[model samples]
Target: MTGVSRLDDPMPDSPSQTTPIPPVDGVLTMFYYNDLQAAADWYHRVLGFEKILIAEGLVLFRIHEGSQLALVGKGYGSQQPLAGTNKGAILSIQTRALQQWHERIASHEAEGIGHELHRGGNGRTVEFKVRDPEGYTIEFFEWVE
Candidate 1:
């Protein structure tokens, strides 16, 4: 992680003299849930995401080598869970084993909300969407080559 700069820091005389910004090493996407444990179980059982860290009202899962997914419980995050519909965001995962993933998720019909694999626009990729316990969409896709 990079150090935070203060607002009162001296300004650079020119662009070349400005402090360099550090490179981003990884990314983390946080999702809020009312029932945190239930959501965590669903993600583990269906998607096989391994939990890296667990804390009070927070759970982090390793999505890949460089990215992670954080699940924040109610009252711990800025926004509460949507009452019925998940409208704003979709958690998308890109993979090369499209059919395999579809089959794996399809087997867990009780927990997996939807499993309709189809071609994306312009025939560039094939994808499918599944809803988590809290109605958040998780899309898996594979780029066509």
Candidate 2:
């Protein structure tokens, strides 16, 4: 056989064969909102997110480093609940600076607000939550270990 490798042949020994695949880079959570621009704007104002795109049926925002939140406009497809409710889901974030994150969220003024620091009974993590404009819950956490 010539030096050229065939498709059926095993690869010659090389570092590439043992290299690991890369880990996940980020996450994007989508929320259905009838008033898409308003929902995007409210998140931008309250949580310091910036608009990343205004594509067909969705407005994307960068909510944190490597994390995104999208507001779905009319005609977007989802198994979402009614326009203003999310009863069984939460957007949980892992953060290192819990206190600083709390300070930023607490600056916002809104109805149905929720914000408090909590320590798990066994003292493993610290966390807090703040409700979004449309009432979906977002939790932030940091491990004590």
Candidate 3:
């Protein structure tokens, strides 16, 4: 008989074992705006996000599959006002397509939105910073693989 170690024994599978993780559904972002209507319009027209829900100065948009973006009216205390401005909070949005996202933001800038778009470190991502009508800053980014 050839010498063999118990360590070479075949492992048995268990019912508790699981494989193949599920993909992430989506992401959600919330923004506190003084004017929900303006925020909704900006996101819809400028960012190409479709409005999914709106109620009493609160608006929610479907930014992507299973992802939502929200605009909440002021006085909710979720955000603080910016220094010397009536707006508050900074929002960052991420995407996988940099060029396409940048073009969209650029179009908004061309319309005199007063926002700036720049390339991030290592040129792997492009970011656009825009202030809402209420002075809150929103940063949109597209990550390069």
Candidate 4:
């Protein structure tokens, strides 16, 4: 990952740059799936995530412009189980073409439409929720301008 070290590095910080030290640029939600290969394929096909690399039992994917998702085989690697069920944390992604994504996801499983395309978040966004192959929630939103 690219970084600038700190707001107070060796030299003086530049004003032309955005935030001195961005609280957080991107997020990589890593998880362990029962079958890494199948999980990778499902994410690639259904969720439209491209595989960046796969070695041993781990798989990395680019979920969006700034976010990523990494998956590992359950028994193939060492990792403490993440808490909660398939309905645990939601992976929210901002989209420019909500309608297109809606159609694509709905085609796979109509029931994945948990929130039934609606305008929410103080009417500032149009979004919907869907479950992945293993039941984790994935939310897609389009900012309302």
lDDT of each: 0.83, 0.74, 0.66, 0.75
Summarize candidate 4's per-residue lDDT along 1-145 as a digit string, tens digits. Answer: 1443433365445663644664778888877777577768778888778889888878999987768898878766567435445545677888898889998888777346853689977777899987666666778898776
Enumerate residue pairs that collide in model 3: none
Which regions of candidate 1 are displaced past 4 Å? 1-21, 110-116
lDDT at 5, model 2? 54
The better candidate by lDDT, 2 or 4, is: 4
Per residue, candidate 3 scores C-alpha lDDT tens digits across 16-107 of 24454568787777777666677678878877888888787578889668878778777654663244344435666676664576677676
- Segments in model 2 whose C-alpha atoms lie over 4 Å from true places: 1-25, 81-85, 110-115, 120-123
Query: Model 2 clash pairs?
Result: none
User: How many steric overlaps are in each model, in order?
Assistant: 0, 0, 0, 0
Ranking by TM-score: 1, 2, 4, 3
Candidate 1: tens digits of C-alpha lDDT, residues 48-97: 99999999999999999989999999999777777654548878899988
TM-scores for all candidates? Answer: 0.79, 0.70, 0.59, 0.69
TM-score of candidate 3 to 2 decimals: 0.59
Candidate 2 per-residue lDDT over residues 1-145, each given as its tens digit: 3564545565877565788568989988887766677777777887777898988778888877788988887567664536555556777877898888788877776444446789852566788777776777877788765
- Which residue runs does candidate 4 get wrong by more than 4 Å? 1-19, 22-26, 76-78, 81-87, 114-116
The candidate scoring highest on lDDT is 1
> By TM-score, is 1 or 4 better?
1
